[model samples]
Target: MNVIIWNCRGASKPSFKKRVRELVQNHNPAILVVMETRVGGDRAREITNLLPFDEAIHTDATSYAGGLWVLWNADRVDITLLSSTEHEIHAKVKVRFTNVSWLLSAVYASPRNAERQILWKNLMNVAELHNLPWVIAGDFNEPLLSEDKFGGRSVSVNRSLLFKECLDKCKMLDFGFAGPRFTWTNRREVQALI
Candidate 1:
């Protein structure tokens, strides 16, 4: 079953709901994750209700910066929450189409370097608990290689190595992507794929 995840930037904006509705109509994902919501409290709940899913889990915004919402169509997917924090939502989801069960971690790693390692630790904890194949997806805020970045202070070798180590320790591998090589851009249009 298809799952759509978006770093929508902010769900509080005027047109966010309409765009999400359109996306839900077009992709029809069994599970939907919206990150960097930039809103919390009852507003986050309102946005979740507006989406086309019967069930949702919300991680409130932290200091008005990062927020996460996980929504799923009850008929297409059954999910059990394993663990969660502001940085990630970890779950075991059973897809009806494939009749398979596995772990899903919807992560929004902190932009702050100091907080990134905590997320890595969280994944290691997840690995310790479940042996199922995993699918971790999000704007991790760190890239795996020098080639994954562009127009930045040369990418951090230390950060990249730490990311690699985390992946190795967790026995996880990149699923790779089919889109433009540069998936993100700066004010100058200099790009990076993370």
Candidate 2:
């Protein structure tokens, strides 16, 4: 099944609606996870309702900082929310016409080390909650290796170490990505990837 994870940055942008429609047409994903929506409450609800999804769940942003939405086409898969926090949303997804079921965690990790510690702990806890196949996806907000950064301060070994430990503890593997080596940039010389 196809799943699309996008850090749309802000759902309130003028082009947001058009961008989402394009993604839907191109990918035809069964599940779509949007991060850093930068909108919350009734505004978040209103915007999400306009998206072309059969169902959705969201965690509101804190005054335009961080927000998350998980949208899906019910005909493709049945999704049940297991739990949610500002940093992450855990759900049980069952594919139609198949016996396959899996746990999906969509994360919008904090840049702050302290807050990220909470995210790591929470992820570990979620890993222990079920034995089903699990997939975690999102903008982690921190690089895990030296190669993950460019045109900036060297990557912090301490930060990468903590993240590495967490992944090892959770028995999770990084599937990496395809296409460009850098997925992000400051547009002013600094380029980074994760």
- Best lDDT among the predictions, by candidate number: 2
Residues 9-67 of candidate 2 have per-residue lDDT tens digits of 89999999999999999999999999999988889889888999989989988778889
- The C-alpha TM-scores of every prediction are 0.91, 0.93
- Measured with C-alpha atoms, the lDDT of residue 108 in candidate 2 is 95
List where candidate 1 sits over 4 angstroms from the true fold.
97-99, 189-194
Q: Which parts of model 2 are misplaced by more than 4 Å?
A: 189-194
Candidate 1 lDDT trough over 10 residues, lowest sum: 185-194
Candidates' lDDT values, in order? Answer: 0.86, 0.89
